[model samples]
Target: MPHHLIRKLEHFTKLSCDDRQVLGAVASKRRTFAEHSDIIEEGNDPSHVNLILEGWACRYKQLDDGRRQIISFFVPGDLCDTHIYILREMDHSIAALTPVKVAEISRASLDRLMDEHSRVTKALWWDSLVGVAIQREWTVNLGQRTAIERLGHLFCELFLRLRGVGLTEGDSCALPLTQMELADALGLSNVHINRTLQELRRAGLIVLKGGCLTIPDLAALQKASLFNPNYLHLDREGRNLDANEPASD
Candidate 1:
């Protein structure tokens, strides 16, 4: 692993000195990705399990006639394949939501690391559980919420997720997505998306101008969308420190 990459993972993974030394002994490569690049494709061979060192991405499945259902967006520090470990081929595809950079850790190396250190493996597994929670939230939104509310819920989720990685501002974030991307993720028509967005704007909830989003009434939007961030398990990493009280550098 590169010295800087090893250092960063150690900060996040809550690794012991011994384990960090072991991982640092191995070579880890960084890979850059362009926006809209397909990092993992449905029905393609699964050769590696990737970790996101930077950028945003979405895991999605497309229906016939080109309709798509976005599973979840991957961000920095997220594992790209926590749920696809035993795959003969990828059952779902992952695409960059923005220009991305990742660390490509081969399966063999990951296996050895897991066998040697369960905490590292468990940390990756925790990521997939969060992904599942995001999917559940989506399922609930699709099944229960109105289109406007669904969009609000998704926006809240994305905003919080981005903020977790320190990629968001106080009440807004850079939105690189088009209306089409929003429609696919929320299962609404692009035209409907525009109308709903306009409604939110008129109601003093949010504003999207020039692809930038500003949420003026976050509390109202969260209430309207019925969004709750408890399922994300974002505090899990901190718990390890509380339990162990190990000196961190």
Candidate 2:
């Protein structure tokens, strides 16, 4: 089976056969969750870290009044959080947005892997930093960008990310998010999300239909969103690690 984690890590640094084998073993324990189910709830101690193998999930914080703010979306190849075992309890919850499959890696296994493979450990660290960077960018998106701009930026980010993991087909990718979900993620009301989608459609910048998002012109969409791919750090930050390993076939 194809491993999205390996594909994602290879974006930053080449992985050796040993590294791949270890990762495959780590990911062997798989579980499935139905849509809208809580994978990990707030205030609970988690013994294992989740590696998303399929479908989408989100980190969200809910208020006393039942309002929810989505913090981040996890696609295939995303780790829910690294070193999360250090926390006494989760501050927020992670839930499945769609039918999800995950590999539950125990803390002990991860510790052994880190101890044995320095390069793999560093690559995981890089992945964690990229998650932080995306969080920062989302803060800016929510606090500064207009509703349309925010949507455009999000679309651009998703396109690039799915592309990185080989999920995108040319200019299109599966969105699988409802307008209500988009509203929650972007901090907009359902009506506002619908109107923004209408605007984007009218401008011919995007074509979203049947759970698929297609950017007719990526450059124009990026310009509209004022998106800078710099925050993503997709440029092989862990490339130096490649020097230590033999060339991969």
Candidate 3:
């Protein structure tokens, strides 16, 4: 079932029983990929929207020198390329960060959902807008924030985002990326990312071990990073709708 997706969309609006059922149907069929495998490559025609059902994936651009810049991380419940069908080809590639399972939502299926389900359509719009907002914040992260601040901000954002989708456990969440991958995402050297991680650990703001990240004090970390959640637009804008499902992680 696409419980995670339902949980995520309900954060925006109340979903009816029918809405949940249809969404589940769309995500019922899934495909799995091994770690490091490419789910979608640059220049591929955008036919289906991939929904992460398990594990992690990233959308990235590769330079001629073979260096990569990870643009965004996709977790369960995330809809990859919701509006990218309008594009003739994908501008970047999406690869699995871990063994991943995704639901390939065909354009025809998506069109039917949007045409019939008003609430789902609205929530999808919110999802797309939030994606752009996150990209903008990432730009600021790479351009202005110091190394330590960048790492902290990214941690806080991921924790909150995972929590919103019911993937977090208390103050900790799964963080499967390696230090090198973190370096690529933040536009820093591997050594810089290592040093920054050490700094965060020393400050008692984070605990990273065994592929898990524990933020003992999220508020303090957010303060140190100057992180703000406004760009996420997670304030439950469609609170008026009737949501029948549970959203607790």
- 44-116, model 1: which lDDT tens digit per residue? 9887767777767888998889878877777675677654567898888999988888777677777787788
On lDDT, who's better, 1 or 3?
3
Q: Determine which window of 10 residues in candidate 1 has minimal summed lDDT.
A: 2-11
1-249: candidate 2 lDDT, tens digit per residue = 328888888767888888989999888899999999999999999889999999999999999999999999999999999799889999999999999999999999999999998778888998899999999999999999999899999999999999888899989999999999899999999999999999999999999999999998999999999999987777784445555658443
How would you encode candidate 3's per-residue C-alpha lDDT over 54-83 as one tens digit per residue? Answer: 999999999999999999999999999787
Candidate rank order under lDDT? 2, 3, 1
The Cα local distance difference test for each model comes to 0.74, 0.91, 0.91
The better candidate by TM-score, 1 or 2, is 2
TM-score of each: 0.83, 0.95, 0.95
Q: Any idea what lDDT model 2 has?
A: 0.91
What's model 3's TM-score? Answer: 0.95
Summed backbone clashes in each candidate are 3, 0, 0
